[model samples]
Target: MPITLHDAFVPTAQQILRAVRGLVDKAERHCAENGVADSELIEARLADDMWPLPWHVRSCWVHSGYAINRFKTGVFTPDFTDIPDDWDAMRDQIDDALTQLDAITPDTLEELAPQTVGFELGGQRLMEMTGQNFLLSFTQPNLFFSCLHIL
Candidate 1:
């Protein structure tokens, strides 16, 4: 049988999920190497416009984490956005994210919701669940690279 668009789309989408995980891992390491143990750095403030780039980058990581839980039928909702307030557990969370995304299949993607508050994307009101989910997956890389550091 010929492949449907989804057959191609899911793997490509998985690569983005994987890349996001990679960058987040890189960022976490960068943070650790430069950090002063269990302390926080002032957030970056380079952007001069609304929806700053760091927000975009961090949201991709956060949303990717959210996507994983929603993707699995028999999994717990991980506290993706929870600041560990500690170092080791934080690194463990990053590792856990990579493991989760590596496990996704089309059957898994079909289980996720976009976690959106708005009614549309690009001014086109979405009518189906799968459409928006895949759309989010498509744009995830856009969000990730817009602020990710070289790593």
Candidate 2:
């Protein structure tokens, strides 16, 4: 069977988003088990100059949410500011991304798959791609990269 755009994009994004959510779970459990504060995990980075953990989490949220909205609306608006500082905020961001994915129907994805659109960030045109190519090449890689960083 041929893969639809929805199949190519939605379920993969959803799975990665769930894995990101699980990272939050593991962090909370680790903090509780070791009597460490969440800040210890939230602020830690592999290097001093690297983004802190919250930035990774925020990037995951932003990438997932941005990919969904951009594919659906053909507008590439992405923001990673206002990083979630605590568990509730992090979970909320994950839930919000999941909700956005859930709102897209298979028909919508089919309608989008053949359309060529601008991929931009901050008013800069990154490139142009058909929706199917956008999903397969652009959004999926960004989502996975952010998810790996979050994990």
lDDT for model 1, please: 0.44
Model 1: per-residue Cα lDDT at residue 42: 20
CA lDDT of each prediction against the hidden true structure:
0.44, 0.80
Give one clash count per candidate, in the order shown: 0, 0
The residue pairs in collision within model 1 are none
lDDT of 2: 0.80
Residues forming the 10-long window of minimal summed lDDT in candidate 2: 62-71
- lDDT at 102 for candidate 1? 59
- Quote each prediction's TM-score: 0.43, 0.89
Specify the highest-TM-score model's number: 2
